[model samples]
Target chain A: MSLLKVENLQAKIEDNQILKGLNLEVNPGEVHAIMGPNGSGKSTLASVIAGREDYEINGGRILFEGEDITDLEVHERAQKGIFLAFQYPVEIPGVSNANFMKSSVNAIREARGEEPLSAKDFLARMREKSALVEIDKSFMSRAVNEGFSGGEKKRNEIFQLAMLEPKLALLDETDSGLDIDALKIVSQGVNTLRNENNAFVLITHYQRLLNYIVPDFVHVLADGKIVKSGGKELALELEEKGYDWVKDHAIEEQTA
Target chain B: MTDFNEDKLIEEVTTSDYKYGFTTDIEQEFAPKGLNEDIVRFISAKKEEPEFMLEWRLKAYRHWLTMKDPMWAKVDFPKIDYQDVYYYAAPKKKPQLDSLDEVDPELLKTFEKLGISIDEQKRLTGVAVDIVVDSVSVKTTFQKQLKEMGVIFCPMSEAVKEHPELVKQYLGSVVPTTDNFYAALNSAVFSDGSFCYIPKGVRCPMELSTYFRMNAALTGQFERTLIIADEGSYVSYLEGCTAPMRDENQLHAAVVEIVAHKDAEVKYSTVQNWYPGDKNGKGGVYNFVTKRGLCEGENSKISWTQVETGSSITWKYPSCVLKGDNSIGEFYSVAVTNNFQQADTGSKMTHIGKNTRSRIISKGISAGRSENSYRGLVNITKNAKNARNFSECDSLLIGDKCGAHTFPYIEIGNSSSVVEHEATTSKVSEDILFYCSQRGMDEAQAMELIINGYAKEVLNKLPMEFAVEAQKLLAISLEGSVG
Candidate 1:
């Protein structure tokens, strides 16, 4: 069974129709890279899959672990192994990232019929995982994403991802605000967390992120539909040619 | 159908009768159902107070007649009918008891339901408890243990009877009878409250706590509390209160005064959970209180911490007077209003001595069409050379319909004084809630985590027992705020 399957997904935010009959599927141990220009609904698709209420899913179904998850709430989707790393990480004042993660991890564990992790064990795991993104212990003690630099925010997201260890992780434009060094660190953290039982979906405007964490497949989205799909070479081809050709081809295909 | 059939169209609102809403049925004694000199005299005579105290009550009542009910506060309520309310009501069958077992079992059960079994508190925790129901204190636990350490802990009535000289010396020293409208009223009619005196250089061996409750119908509750810490002594006190749910709003006007002498320190905490009306804001407690402390000698310290989560309308400001050179005053508060509750609560710091320092941290959480306001004042006089003060007031709104406001008054007299104030108003962000939810917490859990984090500073100031109860009260008060 596929880890995640979006069948003709259609969604909108407010009065704006963003996702129109988008379809995609990811099996275990696979990395799918979604490349699109601005406003092509890349982030919308990621949010819809994560069950963000900001976008209204008007049609179609989302299946996770071979179970229909379209009707699930955001927290339910997350507990069922769907994670969306926000493009703009939210800064919550007065809530330390450590305390936030403790509640979250225990909640997910509780949802999975498992006992909560003891404070000693949880702190031990957190210390170990902080190294995944090279985050300082002090950063974990601070408010979630508060006063962090752009690089630190991205690294913190990846660190949270490492801690939660979701079966399906969605990175929404994860490489947009990062420098080369930070990008390498974030990508390394993502790579370390990947395994045969889990999958990843990376959404980006530029194909540069595909270099560090190489994708098995690349899908080009335009006008809310997948215009083209190919192997890793497709990303290099699009990077070389720009999106105009893909837009023209998509128009041609639509007209035909 | 066009006759405005209000009752037929909608059901009446009954403010949440919380866990402490259980009422014990007992024979009642009552003073006249009105505020007058005679009622004040009746209260004074019933308590068997001395001539000086009776004279003081008469003075306060006469002054109260010339004053008007304060309306400048941010809270709003219907006009209070002073003539309709009984000035005093006490359980006629109860008498002073030396041991907990002698108290009425029904009264004991009421306290038990409120999560405070004085017996359990006595056995498990070292905290001394003074339990006051309606107009009297029935029992005080750990009196013997405290007496050995030269610490006097008893009801105000008992203290006036047993230690008249001490009570006479310090009763109205911090908060005078003419302090405010409510303070004057409390001065005239306050039936019973806690009284404590820490002897010179003695650190109190255990925490002192008081639980005040209002039970009799149509009776306004007025309580007076006084604590005096002698030279080089230290004491920590905690107070908690609740009332039964009713369709008619009940009145609560209390006066609390503290005096700290040379090198003394006093820490006072309150977790006020009066009944906040139902979802439609029909009925709840009207809490108007005057609380103040005086640091009378050099190097003295006074700190006030409060968690107010109930009351239909709350108008209170716990303040400190820094009279001693090198004294310190700190105010920490977390006020929450939900379901048509309105709270205007904060603290005041008056610096009069050289090198005095004070700090204020307040958090206000509003939900369910309620209004929560933080009103504070800081004054540094000319003599307060090198005085320093820092004030931070933060407001958190849960629903879009709720409101939060901050009003801070700062007055600095000399150039050497330094004062800083910072405030932030924010609606509980949907993104933060979503972030927590996506991490697997439900809405209520996420809301509590965020609210607690926002209130961490003020909550940390409460002792362990009160801290736990305050957190739970905050969670309960904010129910139905989020989906």
Candidate 2:
């Protein structure tokens, strides 16, 4: 059985339809990459699945371990092991990174009917995780994402992902503004958090990130639907031949 | 399996009650409801003030008769009838207590409910508390320790007798009898408040604090607070206030004056949580306060920090006059208004000496149809060469029905002065809320964290005990007002 499944998904923003008849399924331990051009509804699918209010789900069924979760709130989904690494993380002044992560972790624990971790336990965990991401201990006292460089911000997102230990992770353009070193760090963090019982949906505009965190399957999303599904070679093929080839082939297949 | 009522959920998520509303049942000394020259004389006579002090009170009374009420604040309220309230109401307990042991049990219980027990607070928080019930000071703890360091901390009535020369010299120096309407009224009929005098070259041993409790109905509390830091001395003072719930509105008009002599520093903090009116705007306290400090000597400094979260209508401007060369002044404030409350508060920094500096930071949060504003003024005199001033005011609106405004007045007479003023108004974005909730925090916790973060700059200025209480109060003040 699939760990996550979407059947006949249709979504809209205002009156304009963005996702029409979208379908996908991912079993446990699978890593899938959704590659598409700008305005091809890739981000829309990620946001709708994460329960953002901007996109209206006209018709869809989202099943997480065969349990329908189409109406869950963003935080509810988060508590149920869904994580979205935002494309542009927000800067919250005076909220320290350590404090925010601790609170987030405790909140998730509370939702799962567990007691809050003591301060000593929480700090010990933070020190361990900080070393994993190479984040300076002093960064824990500074405001969250405030005055952080772009690379640092992306790394902070992964730091949170590691802290929450979500079962299904969505990386939305996480490599948009990262340098080579930052991209390596972020992908390494993702690779570290992946396990046999969890899945990942990497949404991106380029094939460079796939080189760092190798994906098992690549789906070409065009206009609202997945036009083609293939193995890792498809990403290299699309990168070399451009999206026009995929679009023309998809149109030909539809006509034929 | 469950149905959600959006409106009810929103209401439940936003409504917060006053935490320190517990009242103690105790007998009280009461004065007749009215205002007159006899009432002033009666209060002075009750304190057994010297003939010279009585003469001063009579002079202030005569001047107050000719004064008119000032209505420049943006707050709207019914005109206060000075004749319809009692000018003096104190607990009918003993006038003198030999020690904290002899103090009345009811009064002690009241202080405990307000989180300021005489013995425990002194030992745990290192705060010297002077508990003022209604219009008179009940007891002042830690006077012996403070006196060992040549610090004079007592009630205003006692200060008149013990430190007569100091009171005579500094009284009405910063704010005169003819300053304003409320000041004039306070001058004539002020019952009691805290007075502190730190001797030269000495720092206060502990934080000097005063807790004011209004426990009587239809009473007007006029408190006069004066603090003087002699040359090379330093002191930190904290004040907290609360009131019992009553159907009739109470009046609290206070005057706090501070003097920082040459090279001296004075830091004053206030956590004001008086009863704000209920949802329909029926009953609460009307707080009209005049607080100012004078940096009279060269290199002197004065700082004012306040967290105001209560009152039906608050009209206050804690100001500073930097008259000494190279002196400094600072004001940090966080004012939160909910329900039908209204607040018009900020600060004024007047630069009169060369090389003086001043900084003002004001944060106002408005919710539940409340109106909050920051009105400030910064003036540089012609002789103030190379003076510097910076002002920042930010307002946060929780709901569409509320409003926030900033009115800053900047007047520069010195050509060499540098002054900057910035103001911004913002609402809690849905995106920020969603971000927090996505991290598994409920809406209430998310709102609290965000609000705490917004208020961190000013909240850090408060003393430790008061800072924690103020943080909790900030969260409670925003309850039932956010969704």
Candidate 3:
């Protein structure tokens, strides 16, 4: 069974149609890399699937575990084990990262009809996850993302992903501003969290991330549609030939 | 099932009921519904005050008649008819109670419902609670223990009879009768409040607290509180208030004064949760209060911290007079307004002596159709050489319909004084809410987390128990505020 399925999804933000009849499928344990140019509807697909209210679904449906979830609220999707590593993590002053993660973890657990985690267990989990992401223990007590450098904020995002342990995760431009060492650490965190019961969708403009965490499949997104899809070799081809041929090939196929 | 219709949800949540809106049914006594010299005499006579106190009350009453209501605050309300309010009301069958067992069961149940169990506070928190209901002191717990530490903690009415010399010396000494209209009215007809006096070189063993509740209908609650920390002594005091739901707006005018002598420190904290009327503002309490502290001798310090989350209309400025050389003063406040509530509250710091210093931090939050304002004054007097003052005022608006304003007045008379002020206004952005929601928090929970964080500085100044209560009040005050 598929972990997620999007069929002919159409979405728009205020009058601009960003995702026009986009379709994709992710099976359990699969890693899918979405490569696209600027304004190519890659982020829009991730947002629409995560149920962001800013985007209006013009047509089509989203299914999670064979259940229609197109009209669910953002937090509802989150409670059902969907997580989005924000491109720009927000800075909430005076709210410690540990406190924020605790609230998030408990909220998800509550939705699953589980008792809240005890202080001992919660602190232990935080310690383990901070170690996994190579974040300093001091960062746990500081304000969430406040005064954090670009690399630190990206690492915090991965730390949160490990804490939540969502069933399906979407990394939206997570590697955009990361330095080489920070990127390696982030990729290692993701690799450690990947399992057969969950899936990952990595959206990026650069194929450098694929070198560290190789994908099972690669899809080229252009002008609000998946222009081409293939195995891992397609990512290397696109990396070698800079996305121009993919558009020309897509146009040729359309005209043919 | 978790789909949130933003508008509908806000509508449903904003009109949610006030949790502390229930009234206590007890036998009560009342003086006539009017404000006059005779009524002032009536209140004083009921308390059996001394001749000097009666003369003071009459003088204040005469002065009040010549004064007019101050309309400078940024609030709107119907005109108050002095003749329509009951000047005095108290529970009948009041004899000197020996213990909590002697108190009426109904009154105990009322305190229980308010979650301020006097017994629990006495046993666990070691707080001496002096509870005032309907403008009369019901009980003062832990009085004996406090007395062993040379602390004079009792009801104001009792202090007049037992400690007349101290009362006569300090009453109206910090805040004069001519301070303002409400202060004058409170001086003339104030019924009951707490009084604390720490002897020289003694530190109070327990936190002194007062809980004020308005129970009777059509009655105005006027309470006066006075604290005098003697030279080299220390004390921490807490005040909390609430009222029942009513269709007619009730009035509460209070006066609080503190005097800290050489090397002494006094910390006063208030968590005011008065009833703030219905969604349309049909009924609520009009809170007009005057509170000031005096740093009387060198090295003295005084701090005022308040969390205000109730009342339909609030006009208060808890201020400090840094009179002693090398004295220090601090004021921290968090005022929240929702529905049709209006609050204009802040602090006033007057640096008088040489080398004095003061600091002010004010946070205001407005939601629904309410208006919240921070009005503060920092004055560096001409002779206050090398005096310094720092003030920070921040406002947060929840919905588009609400308003937040900052009115800061700074006056520097000497080149040696250094004064600094910072102000900022912000709205709860949709992006922040979206981020929290994406982390599995619903709109309401996310709002709570963000608002608490914004007011964490001021809330942290409160005592541990009061900090918890203030956090809950912030969440309750902001329900259905975000759209």
- Give the number of the best model, judged by TM-score: 3
Docking class of 3: medium
**Per-residue lDDT for A1-256 in model 1, tens only?**
9999999999988999988999899999999999989999998898788877777788888999899988787788888878888888988888899999998999899999999999999999999999989988898789998999989988888988999999999999999989999999999999889899999999999988999999998999998888899999999999999998899988898899
The window of 10 residues in a row where model 3 chain B has the poorest summed lDDT is B1-10
| Pairs in clash, predicted candidate 1 | B15-B277, B15-B278
What is the C-alpha lDDT profile of model 2 across A193-237, one tens digit per residue?
A: 788999999999999999988998999999999999999999999
Superior by lDDT: candidate 1 or candidate 3: 3
* Model 3, span B1-483: residue lDDT tens: 233444544564576678888888899899988988888889999999999899988998889989999999999999899889998998996846587888888999999988989888878888888899887888887888888888999999999999999999999999998889999999999998989999999988777899999998888999999999999999999998878888888999999999999999999999998999999988999999999999999999999999999999999999999999999999999998988999999999999999999999999998888999999999999999999999999998876778899889999999999999999998777777778888998877887888888999999999898899899888877775432
All models: lDDT?
0.88, 0.87, 0.90
- TM-score, chain A, candidate 2: 0.97
Q: State the lDDT of candidate 3 residue by residue for A29-108, as single tens digits.
A: 99999999999998888888888777889899999999999988889999999999999889998788988888899989
TM, chain A, every candidate: 0.98, 0.97, 0.99
Across B1-483, the per-residue lDDT of candidate 2 in tens digits comes to: 011223333354346666666567778777777988888888888888998888888888889889877888888888877789899887777646567777777777777777676778767877788888887887778888888888999999999998899999998898887888889888988899999999999988788999888888788989999999999999999999888777789898899999999999999999999999777778999999999999999999999999999999999999999999999999999999887899999999999999999999999998877899899999999999999999999998886777898999999997999999988888777667767777877666777888888889999999888889998888877865422
For model 2, what is the error of residue B28's alpha carbon versus the real structure, in angstroms, after optimal superposition? 2.5
Model 3: how far residue B394 lies from native, Å: 0.7
What TM-score, to 2 decimals, does candidate 1 have? Answer: 0.95
Judge candidate 2 at residue A215 and give its lDDT: 91
